[model samples]
Target: ARPCKIVEMSTSKTGKHGHAKVHMVGIDLFTGKKYEDICPSTHNMDVPNVKRVDYQLCNISEDGFLSLLLENGDMREDIKVPEDPSLANEIRSRFDNGDDMLLTVLAAMGDEAVIALKFNTK
Candidate 1:
């Protein structure tokens, strides 16, 4: 699942280089667990760790699709199935029909860039 929204972000100067550098500390929406890491120097952006979580969530979504197919007795013996088979179509339909507000929330949290970074990392 996608993580809850970032409730807060705090920064602290790490050191005095030729220019000042800072690190970011953030808390998740539900757990409120705090995590600290360095920001990208050039952009002051969080160093794309959010993408890792998003990729994991995408894997979980795929697994959920597989589980659904298995439960519905729709999985084929062949691993190489067509991209838009019935199961795939059903999954896509459900995913598209469902108004998953969390997705929008994640997108607001810069998930698009994170997802792009995840693909590049792979």
Candidate 2:
């Protein structure tokens, strides 16, 4: 199965010589692209192993990527900054003010990205 979030789904009745079909419309969680497919109602589907972890933004690279310190104290520099313009500005501003930032990292099937950022007290 693709790493997408279901946006809509529908089922159609089976015709005289047809099997029932389930149609799903989804959006790729990482890329924000649309995906649609139809399959038999009995078809087994795969689900990606998505994990969310909270980390602290420890450093910002010259290229704008982030260095996040995980709960275990390990630093991750692999995930790039979010592509959303507004969120990126928010992160940049928050990081500049020496704020305690809580960064939520999302990972699935070895693919990871920064999904959320927020200021924290303490």
Candidate 3:
């Protein structure tokens, strides 16, 4: 299951013979897509385990793979720049200008992506 950020959630009062209903609107964390669901208030929903890590941007390959420096002095290359052209261009431009960059990567359900970037403070 993909991880989503709940944009809106509300509960409707129960009727005489029915359980309360919950209406939820969520945006996919990785894809920027919207999803809506209505369920009984008593129902259990599956929540994906999501992790975020900040990595030092070291290099970007020609085909878009990112070379990130791990905290423990290791390099990881599985994630790529985000699909948004503006973000990708900003990342590349900053790196090309020799600015130290820190990239925030979000991982969930075996999927990972670079979600944000900022200058490295150190």
Candidate 4:
């Protein structure tokens, strides 16, 4: 499942004694794809367990895999590049240029990887 952020919410009443349906409009946080859903107020939706963590780009393999160093001194080499082509290109470019990079990794539950690179202003 992809991560989603609700941008709008509207409710509609079918009758005097009926359930209220909520119309939710959301945009994909990464892909910027528009998504909309209508459901009862009592309906439960799946929310992705996401966390933001800092990672350092240690290396890049010939196959284009990123080797990241976590805050706890553990190495993670399986993170895929983010879906945004421009962001992905920027990340690689910064790594190649030997920039001081502090990557904001969006760790989503079990599969954790979305790179938001922040570089030193100097």
Candidate 5:
């Protein structure tokens, strides 16, 4: 299942011969693409389970792979830094300054990405 974040939702009043309709606009969580769907209000829809994890920013490779410090003292290096230019620049500059940072990673449908960053509170 694809994970999406709903950004807009609207409902239409029931017609004389049909049930109410629901319109939804969502953004693809991983790709930043727009998706829209319309269906009867009573239809059953599957919702994807998304997970957010915060890991210590250990290192960033020249090729953009992120080394994340996991809670179990292990390192995760498979996730890459995002392609957004502004965010990527911010991350690289802050890390180069020796700041302790925490990366917020969002995961769904066996795919994961670095979505945000925060200063380490400790």
Candidate 6:
């Protein structure tokens, strides 16, 4: 992971029949690595309402939240240990569905929001 800052955001109608979309560009504040991603629509409000600085902080918070969740002992019980085949399949299916939804939302973020996220490696 690298520390980064959102430098710019832009949105445009994806296609005549498709929904609007947001594109974000970020620069690594520490190492100067740059990145770009399309934000889904659901994240649209996350950017503009929060602004660039706030958005970066929020991303850090989110990453922390995920890390904490993964570290918590309770999460170990949330899934079958030793990886039950059936349970693993079900979990994978659910994750795939969620990923699709996330992609859809990300692709729909309009220009007003800062869709870029910066992360620092531990």
Error of model 3, residue 75, in angstroms:
0.7
Per-residue lDDT of model 6, residues 28-49, tens digit only:
4423579888855546333322
Clashing pairs in 1: none
Task: Please provide TM-scores, in order, for all candidate models, with all chains considered together.
Answer: 0.25, 0.91, 0.94, 0.83, 0.91, 0.31
How many backbone clashes are present in model 1? Answer: 0
Spell out the clash pairs found in candidate 6.
39-106, 40-105, 40-106, 40-107, 41-105, 41-108, 48-113
RMSD of each: 13.3, 1.4, 1.0, 2.4, 1.4, 16.7
**Candidate 3: deviation at residue 51, Å?**
0.9
Off by over 4 Å in 3: none
Candidate 2 deviant stretches above 4 angstroms: none
Candidate 5 structure quality by residue, lDDT tens digits, 8-119: 9999999999999999999999888999999999999988888999999999998999999999999999999987787788999999999999999998988898889999
Error of 3 at 121 (Å): 1.6
**Predicted candidate 6, C-alpha RMSD:** 16.7
lDDT of 1 by residue, 1-122 (tens): 23444444555554555434445556653244676655545563433334322221121143332211232445322122113355345434544564221111123243322111111122
* lDDT, candidate 5, at 89: 89
Candidate 2 per-residue lDDT, tens place, 1-77, comes to: 56999899999999688789999999988878999999988898888889998888888898988998877878888
For model 2, what is the alpha-carbon lDDT of residue 5?
91
Candidate order by decreasing lDDT: 5, 3, 2, 4, 6, 1
- Candidate 4: tens digits of C-alpha lDDT, residues 75-116: 988877777788888988888899877777775546566658
lDDT of each: 0.35, 0.85, 0.92, 0.79, 0.93, 0.37
Flag regions of model 1 displaced more than 4 Å: 1-17, 44-122
| Model 3 residue pairs with clashes | none
Each candidate: how many clashes? 0, 0, 0, 0, 0, 7
Instruction: Look at candidate 2 and give me any clashing residue pairs.
Output: none
